[model samples]
Target: MDDDIPTRMFYAGRRWQVTDMPTRIRDSVWATEPGTGRGFYGWRFQATDETGESFVFDVYPGAEGWHVHHCYA
Candidate 1:
């Protein structure tokens, strides 16, 4: 997993700039079903923006690339 990477995201109809490098908060692997198939890996992060607001974000690998799953300010 990549750490301390700068990223940008569009949320709530606005673009949020990740002012600082993102820090990994947690990591997890979960199965698609109950002991049925291969699982997926994901990560959570915490970042602070230029406005001094802290935000929580998540990212996961996909067909395209690492996608920003969600964020909370």
Candidate 2:
């Protein structure tokens, strides 16, 4: 992450560019991965492909790196 912000990503055989400002999401009710206390859970942002298809993604950091937790098309 560049300064803890998401800019672009490649997923589903296509490159996606973040179209809107990213918002950090915190989970106080659930335990965060790789940490004991509540901390940075993930990021929520809208992205678009070259074909102009857009999706909202929820991504989180893990021991293996970043992961796409969910996506809303």
Candidate 3:
């Protein structure tokens, strides 16, 4: 992330450029089944691309690193 904004993202073997600051930034956490001592944290955003198309993108922290979980066009 650059200046709290995603500058680029990869999806479907291609890279998409984030042209504007993300809107509606949200965060959440989910508990795992039955006291497994595990949970998941997520961050979601609605942003526009350089081509003027809108998309929903998500990023989550995992054991390894931050990952792009999903993208909706």
By lDDT, the best candidate is 2
Clashes of 3: 0
Between candidates 1 and 3, name the one with more favorable lDDT: 3
Supply the TM-score for candidate 2.
Answer: 0.81
Which sections of candidate 2 miss by over 4 Å? 29-40
Single out the weakest 10-residue window by summed lDDT for candidate 2: 28-37
TM-score of 1: 0.49
Candidate 3 structure, TM-score to reference? 0.49
Question: Candidate 2: which pairs clash?
Answer: none
- Candidate 3 local Cα displacement, residue 73, angstroms: 2.7
Q: Which candidate is the best by TM-score?
A: 2
Backbone clashes in candidate 1 total 0
TM-score of each: 0.49, 0.81, 0.49
| Positional deviation of residue 62's Cα in model 1 after best superposition, in angstroms | 0.3
**Residue range 1-73, candidate 3, lDDT tens digits:** 6775566766555566765556533232445554564666655666565556777777776898767777777
User: Candidate 1 lDDT, tens digit per residue, 1-73?
Assistant: 3353546655455555665556553333455565665655555656555565767777766897766677776
Q: How much is the lDDT of residue 42 in candidate 3? A: 57
List ranges where model 3 is wrong by over 4 Å. Answer: 23-41, 46-54
Pairwise TM-score winner, candidates 2 and 3: 2
* CA displacement after TM-score superposition, residue 51 of candidate 1 (Å): 2.2
